[model samples]
Target: MFGVGMSTAYARKLRWCTLNARFKDSAIVARPGAIRAGDRETFMKIVRFILALAVGIVIFSLTVAAVGAIGHGFYPPPAEFQQIGDRMSDAMRAQDQAAFERTQVELAEAMAAYLPTAPTGSFIFVVAAWITGAFVGGGVAAFVTSWGRRSVAMLVGVADVGAIILVSSLLPGPGWMPFVGIAGSLIAAFAAGTLVASGTRTKPSLSRKAAP
Candidate 1:
């Protein structure tokens, strides 16, 4: 009877306050559906990026094949040359130096047509093929990409550099040739990538209406 002033209305008010806070907290947190949707969107972006890289590599291979076809057409090896080459392979297998020299003379005669032509064209073609491939591939990667376009393009550039180094080691050309090839490949690829990335921008749709 002494604490009667602590009435039912005050007790009701305290209970309502506690319920309100719980509801507010629940609203502040994200729903599970929204979180799942966001994760799916991120996964899709990564998939598209992988596809873009694959397309770039395919484009590079096609460019190399096209350039190689041109070289094969321009300097077609003769049937006799093929036969001599086979015989030379047989000599090496049998460890016969005498037979190797005989085949070598025939091969020299067979390759006479190419001698006067000079190997400058072959060197130019190889370099041109690499440069063109890098440019085309990097451009494609950048064009297809929406995120990290420059990074993807750089990967293509580095791939071209790796290929150039491998071929240079096998062919053993002049000491300076690999440096030139690597520089040319990286420059062409990165430049094309930068161009493509920058080109995608369209001066943000003028948000405000033009003045009357």
Candidate 2:
């Protein structure tokens, strides 16, 4: 028969293990920053996650390029503007202010054909492309970051959204596109982060039962 003292000791050990498991589980969800000393494996996993986030951004950019090409083919920009744009660049490089200014005005007029007047269908396609790129990129980031902190995956989405804003400013698009694109990017990233974080969570072991 088990003695009273021995039973108490067994219960205490179980309690300690339960608490320890809880702590470790919480740490697993956060990953990275909680790496215990002498745990080189965790440190390397974190490094890989960081590198994965960078690669995610590259993927996003490439997707945007491909999608943009497809969209442009459907609703191409003013054909004449390309030739005028080159002339404008040459004028500026040559320091021919008069020619530069004239070409600039002409280029603006050509671009205007699409801006503030292009069909809503084309605008939808372009905006959707950017959003889709961020969505798919975030998912890839999450998959690669599966072995580490999921929050890091979000950085890719945030960075891409910021880039979208910057590019939009340089080549002004419809006012609404920026708002929609930014919102969509964030939603996609949060979803990816949540999936990876939850999927990696550790469950307490139940394989062994304490002897009575």
Candidate 3:
């Protein structure tokens, strides 16, 4: 009888161990699935942000192109500058590095001379085009992303300012141009972000009584 009782206890203990092992195995499997689901969600958010940024950039480029075309039409470069530009293009097409470099130097010299003497209208147009692009592009980005998210829009604005700075540096524009571009782009970005953030707020109904 004692031997039989000992055998029964051992069997119960074994059964309990088996059940516990199964529970732990199920928990381990469930945890990995949860982690994978979370990771997928995070990845999707990242993808959405990237797509938004790309769209914003494309829009910004289009805006800049349209405004720049108008500016160019209004303030055509000097004949000499145009001639040098044509030469530069030809050199590039022909893959003539030496000629390209020489033409580039000539173009730089002409631009430096002309920019100093250029009318204020030209600079105004350049700055205006960039500022407008930044505002519109940043706003669009903010609209596409969540109302609470502004990083994408702010990045678009940063791109605008960076592009302007790069162009100015390469073409050697007025010393103040970079600073102005930075300031304008920053303000535009902030305005876009503020607009989006405000959109998320609920307006109180007129019928609601004032709090005591």
Ranking by TM-score: 3, 1, 2
Q: 61-92 in candidate 1: lDDT tens per residue? A: 78877886787577554577789999999999
Q: Per-residue alpha-carbon lDDT of model 3 for 1-212, expressed as tens digits?
A: 99999999999999999999999999999999999999998888777778878888788788878887799899987999879989989998999999999998998888888887898788877887888788778777777765334787789889998898789878767777778878898788768867875674434443254544
Please give me the total number of clashing residue pairs in predicted model 3.
0
Clashing pairs in 1: none
Of 1 and 3, the candidate ranking higher by lDDT: 3
Which predicted model would earn the best TM-score? 3
Q: After superposition, how far is residue 104 of candidate 2 from its true place, in Å?
A: 7.9
**How well is each residue in 1-212 modelled by candidate 2, as lDDT tens digits?**
57988999999999999999999998887686545544876777878788788877888888888888888888887768789989989998999999999997887777666587777877888777777777767767777764644566578779878987896886688788889988887787777767766665633232233323
The TM-score that candidate 3 achieves is 0.74
For model 2, what is the C-alpha lDDT against the true structure? Answer: 0.77
- Candidate 2 TM-score, C-alpha based: 0.62
Worst 10 residues of 1 by lDDT: 203-212
Q: Which ranking of candidates, highest lDDT first?
A: 3, 1, 2
Please give the RMSD to the true structure for each candidate, in Å. 7.0, 11.2, 6.2
Which candidate number has the best lDDT?
Answer: 3
Residue pairs of candidate 2 with colliding backbone atoms:
none
Model 1: lDDT equals 0.78
Q: What TM value does model 1 have?
A: 0.66
